[model samples]
Target: MRSLLYSSLLALCGALWARAFAQAAATQKRSVPPGFVTTNGRNFELDGKPFAFVGANAYWLPLLNTERDVDYTMQQIQASGAKVVRTWAFNAINETELPSATETGLTYYQVWNSSDWVVNDGPQGLQRLDYVVSSAEKHGLKLIVTFGNNWAAYGGIELYINWIYGAENATHDIFFTDPAIIASYQRYIKTIVERYKESSAVFAWELVNEARCTGDILSAGPNCVPGSNTLKTWYSQQSDFVRSLDANHMITAGGEGQFFSAHPAEYWFDGSLVSDYNFNGQAGEDFAGDLELPNLDFAGYHMYPQTWYPELDFPGSNFSVEEWGLGWISDHASAAAKANKPLIIEEFGVTGLQNKTDIYPSWVQHALDTGHARVMPWQFGVLGLTEDGGNRAIKYSDQIFRGASPNDGKTHSTLTRHKYGISSQRLRVFKANALDSH
Candidate 1:
């Protein structure tokens, strides 16, 4: 009958409408809005909802050779439930301009050619970063791109100082005060920020990887003594400069949470001479003061009490690893609360020999329980590579130290995989705690 046909047509129309509505809702959920990440009180907000995460450091992501490698790294990161990643955005290098073959058979190394300082082009340049950003988007991971380095590994501050002051005259302090060096750094920052300003995959911009004054180019020393205001001023300038360029993203001074003299006296682990060299109250970094900067969004610190203060008979002693780590977290979290910002453990890990696999998840639980935003372990390793073959495990180092042997290849690879498992566990903890907190 005509009435039966009319009813069937009405049902079909209703079904089509419902399907379209469902598809639209799914699309909206998948698409993160522009400037999607923002701070709400002490927590991060993304797409109008609170965002808490367990992130990891993939410092060498851009150095990976192919798109497949980059994609694989992201897959591993996502598999571990890490929603954010910290990576290096700078690689300062000395290049030589070869003369025409007919003219001369001589080559000269150039360190200061402005044109050669291309941060956005070439195979190993920002094009690689572009792929990282895109792949991270594909894998649903966010990036915290650090602008420079404090160590010499990736042509750090020393390279910039050497370019302007020559190797003999270069000092880490000059990188902060010298007008020419500051200008050069600002130009590099401008280049990268402008290029990636529109990408939602970028979660934040860190000023440097463990920004510190290491005295001069020749000495591998602890941070420079904190007698002057140059370092603080430099942090403010760089952070404000980034804010000026990109109004959407967050900023953090990538300091080591080396507290100044005002740090609580109880948390001071001055039991060893190494502490004097590494954690002296005068180590030119003020975590609390740095957070006071208006442009800086959050605070970050690394926890390596086992390595940094080894004299404190940990493991079996009253000062257990968990106690030591929890103390640091408590102190930094208190400081962040006072600053009215969220705290993130940007780096923390124990060696394979220490056998503290549970510590990673414990730290994550402690961080979430104590109102901290997130905890990112020291690093995530690449697949199919051993320590001897140049894959640095989270805890094992390929670089030989004075009294320690290089990490045993197979053992370290196993430990690295085990650490990945720990990270996966930490993610579970974060998820469970996040649900409870909400």
Candidate 2:
């Protein structure tokens, strides 16, 4: 009888021990946070976990794009393991892209005519913003939207370019420092925040789109004018304005190229901001200078091998894919490691290469492995579809960026999960058979 009792007691202890072990494993898993930023182990996370982005860009307007090409694009984007899409909030020209205040029968702003910003309260202009927010929620994607640019008519870069070059060839200025403009911007921010305070689809708010030639913008040159300081002040004010209105989302300037260093990130933006750079790592066009950039969250690089190194013959020009991808990855990685920030390839896509479709996955993988940057291809749609379709990043090339080679009038969608190291579970697959169960 004593022997029987001993055996029973031993079984009970073993059972308890197993239960405790299982509980401990559960606790450990719970300790790690999810998403892009985390609290332990790797020191950061994406989508609340140790994450990586395997996706493309969603340019222009989120509301209109999603309804039109986004549905198809999302399938490709999701299949590629992308959880975020980047776009611009307003076009520069104010053509008619701004949506109604309560448009789309939702809480977000949809795209109206690109000219809506120039004329206030026109028949179609006077509407409230709601559709944009709603459309994003419906689309199952997060938006990284920029507020300012020099495109169309809202002129930021165009004016600067003109100042740098000449007035005849320059674009007009959509100075941000104008008081009425500031007020109007504030109104837009307030409406967006109020409408989507509870929404989770927003990734981050970008302040401006690539402020090139700060010298020209600040100069007394013909197109230069005298508003560089005003523009700078306006840029700072609008950033603060957005932060004041809503503290829930992340904020960064949609700054292009040297603008990241044009204004130091520490002084201009809060510590949690993300700034961008183009092909080179050094300040200005000097690619061989020191690459350290202080206080940036993510290093951004737009890998256009054909642009700077035009001698090669690939898409933009002509270069071997291996050389181009390696060079870009090397530069991005060097900068990112210096900044101690996660890197993001803010934009990149095959423009006019013979084998663009086949080469995309290889380059993307190179970016993931070497650059260690989250990437967003360009443009979902811009022409007329409520979805993605344009020469921006994800579509065919245009006159400005068509490079030497051009598309052969073929539209194909052949996205595979393995290329991006992703699976249906949205986890990276390192090897064909080795799957991450978690």
Candidate 3:
């Protein structure tokens, strides 16, 4: 959805990260060596060498209809020089509620039966995710697999509340506190972590995607208070749960870097006074507090000045989007340094193509200068791909992107049929091993 100018520096040094594995089909062992990418103060270290890199968000990589879909998508991402690919490892639906992708035999990690929810680990389920990890391992890419979502694209928090309470339109903040919801989410994550516990391709286990005090399906419920102590305790406890499952791979709370505060007007960005709820913790982000969590490995934030702070783009303010974006990045960078943890701009993008071309280069450069660990734009685009039946908003369709040609491979009947192919094994091993000589 978002784009950034290519970074040769990221390509040159990114692939040093190691660890994780893949179940090629069912539970077959993969070839990626067993070594983890660890954090040292403010940088990612693989075998004790700095492992900063560039990545892209391609949430649909594991949601495609066939192996041919995986082939072309992985190639384009690999060609773009991204070593890390963050994606959703989740999908949900009640027994009667069927998504269209299900009709096409696409995979969903979980589904609600008539009585209760169930994980679909058969060929209809986690095997698809297995192939994605296998492809990442073969293609020299590390994956940051998020367990669930805040929004309801593929069965996010709304689905959980609906399934649990037998009601529609429940708020998401309750997801942080409710005991039943917490236990349910833990079961889902435990299934995934134990499945890939020894795999060398998994870089990190992200707890959720852009979790916050509010969500799109409904307003904040009474039990869900924004800017309260809800998230800090949840993050600490859940991270402990994941750490207990896989001690080597890193764990992070996938938040938008919103810090909590009492006085909304007190927080300032770049010496400017603004009481925006985003910075004041009304959105339930505590970037500094997250960094200090005992089990979290790093901290992350997202940016979209055009949408999150539209005033910067107004004609009278004389403030450009990119200028404001730089300030946002600067604030998080300083916070990361203070906390002695690595930072990642997990998602960032502008809306217009011209604005992106003018803005993204400086953001990448600023990350380099500020000592941040990674910069992954909103998404890695592919030619001729349709998302959510092509109705998903073109939220960040800026910066002309180049992608591989449309998918041409034919569909197959069984999982093993598509497990191995030239494209699947076409990992950029040279770049991944670029730092081996040292």
Please provide, for model 1 over 81-140, each residue's C-alpha lDDT reduced to its tens digit, 9 standing for 90 to 100: 567899888765555432331132111112345323544365545677889999989998
Stretch of 10 with least lDDT, candidate 2: 1-10
Model 3 C-alpha RMSD to native: 9.8
- Worst ten in a row by lDDT for model 3: 20-29
Better of 1 and 3 by TM-score: 3
Off by over 4 Å in 3: 1-4, 7-33, 99-101, 166-170, 222-227, 261-274, 384-438
Looking at model 1, residue 255 earns an lDDT score of 81
Which pairs of residues collide in model 1? none
For residues 1-438, what per-residue lDDT tens digits would candidate 3 score against the true structure?
A: 111233333642343223101101111112223466777666676664556678877776776655665766777677767778898899876666455545655567777865358888877678889889888888888889899988876788867777665455556777888788889899999999999978878889999998877788666766545546577888998999999888788889998888664554343456887677766777776777678886788888888778876645677776677877787888898888787777888888775544544466567666655667488877565653433433332112221112222121211111111222213222333223322322
**CA lDDT, every prediction?**
0.63, 0.40, 0.67
Give the local distance difference test score of model 3: 0.67
Model 1 TM-score, all chains together: 0.74
The alpha-carbon lDDT assigned to residue 112 of candidate 1 equals 41
RMSD of each: 12.4, 14.5, 9.8
Q: For model 2, what is the error of residue 126's alpha carbon versus the real structure, in angstroms, after optimal superposition?
A: 10
Rank list by lDDT: 3, 1, 2
